[model samples]
Target: AMDDREVLLTRQEVTVAEHGDWAEVELYEAYQNQTWERQEVVYYFSLPESAVITGLWLGDSAERSERFAYRVSPRGAAQAVYRHEVRRRVDPALLEQIGPRQYRLRIFPVEPQRRDWDQDTNRMVVEDGPSLHMWLTYRVLIKIEEGGDVWPLPQLAEKRNVYWDDTSDRLVNGEPMAADEETWLPPAVPATSFVEPGIHRVDFPGGESVIARPASDEDLPAWPEDLHLAVVLDRSRSMAGRQAEVRAALAQLRRIADSDTVVDVYLTASEYHGEEPTLVELSWLDLGSITYAGGQNAAGLLAQFEALHAGQEYAAIFVFTDGSGYELGDGGFDVSVPGAPVWMVHLGDDLPLGYDDATLEAIQASGGGVAGDVREALTRLAVALEGEAYDVVDGYVWDVLPTEAADARDALDGDFAPFAARWLILAEMQRHRGEINELETLDYLHDVAVEYGVVTPYSSMIVLVNERQEKLLDELEARGDRFEREYERVGETEGQNALTVTGVPEPEEWLLLALAAVALALLYLYPRLSARGTLFTKVSHH
Candidate 1:
């Protein structure tokens, strides 16, 4: 039963000071018994009526470093109203209570020098050795009603609990302190009036007023006339099975095109027989022209747009691609349009698109557009055409569709859940970039990809490429060391042979000697041959 005993409090004190619309209460207590194992101490404060607990400040003490946990809760509450395990500081907003009349504070202390049981005491003591002293001080701030008098200061309840002994006890009696023994109090400042919930003005006695209002929705810009719409279609081999969906989406878009809206269609692929991405009417779009082949050429499509929309002020471009063949060609697509926005419609499902998500996002972001599925792009387009404001939720702007627009977009047969899921993954990764290491980021990407059944190069291709690049650099370094060693060996050999003659023949000297011998032989043979020829001819004639 030694562990079933509670540490007796030797001394206790409570002090309260009244400020305008606020009261600061300070509690001081001392404990003689202590334990090496962590122990919990609980304190309760019964607050006045119409009191709003605003802030709490924990006083510094010798046991501050040993304090492992602190929690505050309403009277008789099952769960802690405010709990902090790693931080001692508590905020006012966290402790805001409108109707609670009582609050409890709990602290856990761990002293390394004390033992759990004492043999001489014949009962549970903090430690078996000399008396160990422990103390705690706490300050609580409460806000009261305006024009209300601060009387009946917060009273400290005698009931307390010890975790090691699992028993409740009362504070031991101590001599009452005189009023002069209280600590010095700071002067109270004037409290400002709390602003009303809605838009209003609070006028003070000094002719000054403060305006408070909720944020207003921004007005949508006017829909411009002469709006030129450009549609870029990807006719790559990867889009073979998805051509029907692409065509259906285009058909829906054609329906939205009005007289003021001039729609131009362009086809992009690696190889085109003739001048491709040529201008065609909406009626001319058919399955025959959707011959999927070659690679996707985003740059070529952008060039077509530049040529077609020259000098056009109000225009919008929609790019439809299955995200394949994006890596086949140069990604240097100049997507900068002064007054035009480019929306990317990512097609297909769960396939590894050639273009990385970052590249596509950058392209869309350059034009202040979004990259999503076909339906999302169409829905946003409809909202823009109708001159409706984008919905602002949770600090992010969203393009919400009207009922009619939603119905129209639903008619198109394509799913964008994969792209949406991928975007969520990317957003999370970007948000936690500074907090997580590279390995952690990769692990998160892998886990998310498996959960959503999506393909992401972050966990696969990108990591592989990085590893390959590292291996290549290592090989190049090894080769460089070998070359350096060979050069040094050759230099050392030449240095050793510096004084010795190489005995190598000089080509100039040998050539001059051969020339001299040939000249002598030719001079002697020419004279003898001329004399003999003349004598032989005269004897033959006789």
Candidate 2:
């Protein structure tokens, strides 16, 4: 079975994707306009430098000089610059080894001599490929390897995936390493060495040691587990124009951290003079481990982010960019930001791909399976990314909601725009995860409440409504006698998931606020649904 459909790009053979070209497009001469326009021929090929010499390379032309020779240069802060050329032409003699007799070409990395790792940072690391951009000199990021600087992790490890402490609750390289720590390990003594500042790599006596820059709250209390956060910033030259937006977003993120969020930031430019090819985290955000010049590395930066997210019950991530994700080694993103839940604050409407509606999903798939396009996707992707970044998941009910609530709220407004938009938000939260219920749902919903300035009751009608809703409390209290008698003292935390009534959703600070709104709404609706008192009636369902 001859696979004539198979084509080789840089060595690996791929079955051609089903796409319609002029060759596939059905067309017929319609009377008077028999003369064909030059634009009539639709070309699907990519060009060297976009803008002119348009369409496919039907053959060689002097204008197609780019096809013969091209070079890439670093734009900003060690950004990798990639150039594409025929690194090697297939030897006519090698055709016998290939199955197809017509022609078999061999292609390798555009910069086949490169020793640095390539990156496709727009997606997850373990699955994708690195960008084909030319190498740039980046700063040396030293992670303290086990037993005196052992093997460097090929890629940055995501949080909650890597570990070191005997107890998951204990620090790993000095941060919450595991999310299931509460149920897994019995608590242990706080390691003081983890709290001390400096670049000392000390063995943890019995437990494993991870890369970290020691920092802790000495004058203050410990950070709550849910407060941890990670901030990723795109530093490509295309983002240079939108730096203010990014900085503003960062400043706001910083202010939040000052109150309850533990924020750590990372910047991705080209690899510049660094020992490895990787995106760099320039600032640790830890006040204790300040260098004379004030710069940081991956471990230090993440440590600070963990500290910021340390104590608050809620956690969030605000990633402001035009959405031109990085090209990383192993061909994907080196992400380790872990928390109770992650909220990605993607900004603007600009996309990494040149076309409209380009998405993280699309950017992750853009690699043509050739090393060249993958490398170039890292830098040139910003070309389309230079404009604005917009959330592709439009319509609030669509399920996969935008990560950041505030950003989503900003893009939303109008008549039904207010309340209906909010409904869309709750609808969005519920879409991401199905476990959301009365209290958990309102926690996210209350962000809309605050954004809408409905935090406090406004009118007397709102007040009266709130008061009337108190009847539910009375009704629940009336059942106290029956509840205690029917439901005996439980064994352990087991049987906690029993399906029963008389159970109230324990509202958190945010939920109480939402419940207040619900009270107001119920009060107003009393004339309709209830005719008089509460949403619930006096009865022991159990």
Candidate 3:
């Protein structure tokens, strides 16, 4: 503390702020007694080429005149690269392609010429005291291109040099900066943003932006009429807890359906018990008296849908279950009811083991339908009946344009225009399911990718099933090890008994060895002995 000849960096701090794909980084440094020192600070960072520099600020105040002139250069480059500079504080400073990998920002602070005595040398020397303060802030937008994987650039490391007056400059500490002293900034963590396969609107800080190109209006179809909805609810013992929720959802469906709409309600459980899943009139339908019992039979329920709607044409059929049902084989559900989309509503968390969400998705997709929760299934039915362009997020219903309806129809697999006209509504439902999260969702998607050869943006490198499989393998290995140890113990016990049989065999050992030898002899001779007559036959022949 007594030595005034040493320079010290008293304070250094860094702050990072993130907004969606964009991030703002600020670096602040304060040196002790270095106000008159002329120092050059260079920041080295790496960013994806897709990223664009949005803004830059130098000094403590935005209103303050630029006291430092900064230059940006690409990695391994000798000269500074000049690009577009925005004078307005609100605007961002743009830089052109400097290089492929890394970039550097060099900042030079203005300093006054001064001199001081070298106390150690007892001679005059130029003052190089640490008394300077500098703050640098910049914003970058990490643009994610279509079908491209990109992450935000991390914080940059600082390279600094202090000059002895204006004439002579020396590197700080006379050596390279210590790794610990040069703080490396961490990358900004991006928020989870979901984008459905089809075109949809995404809300950002400034305004709403549309992601993915939308289907053209000429591609949609007209809304269908004479549409009938059949709801097949799972009344199994497992669904006992969710009965109230099912009743409420049914009530909501009744409210949404028009008076002319024909809604048939069916409940399935063990042996097709309870109400027989009959086509009860909407008004006479009783949600209260419905009881839960038996094991779930999804096959029987589908058979009923096929029987009831044999001659009649239905707009859509919904089968809601706890996803626990008789194995419909590896191919899953292949039955398709003509002129109807069989929407599979997988209710509750107890999905069948070995069978995943992709199986249900494939089943529903094969039947020209979709699979989701109770709310989503009903919402799709409602939207189809309305036959209008409705935005699920805004809840705004637009007048059905001929071209728009045609575009919607083209989006779907069938000629049913209503199903297509409300494609956006369906798109919203597909993306906003509650079951999707970071961990499980990624794993589920990975399973889907492996099984069905389909990969989405949500797919992660980590396979979710691997952990469960590993646990199972560990359990099996432990059981095998225990069996092996038991087997060794039995062998050891037999060997000890053999050792006890010394010159004079113990009665028990002699008896056991005799029995074992007889057992072995019988096993060896059984096949050949069977060719000869039985003991009773031999006695009789003799």
Give the TM-scores of the predictions, in the order they appear.
0.31, 0.23, 0.33
- Candidate 3 lDDT, 391-486, residue by residue in tens: 222121222233322333223222122222223222322343344323344343334323322112221111111243234323432331211111
For model 2, the superposed segments whose C-alpha errors exceed 4 Å read 1-226, 273-317, 323-346, 354-542
- For each of the candidates, the C-alpha root-mean-square deviation to the true structure, in angstroms, is 36.2, 33.3, 29.8
Per-residue lDDT of model 1, residues 91-181, tens digit only? 1111211111333344333222232222333232223222222332222223233763223344443223332211212121233432221
lDDT, model 2: 0.24
Q: How far off is residue 30 in model 2, in Å?
A: 12
Ranking by lDDT: 3, 1, 2
Residue 51 local lDDT, model 1: 30
Tens digit of per-residue lDDT, candidate 2, span 301-372 = 223334444454423333434533321111222223243332323355332221111121112122111112
lDDT of each: 0.38, 0.24, 0.39
Tell how far residue 427 is off in model 1, in angstroms: 16
Runs in model 3 deviating more than 4 A are: 1-226, 272-277, 326-334, 348-362, 366-372, 381-542
Best by lDDT: 3
lDDT of 3 at 67: 33
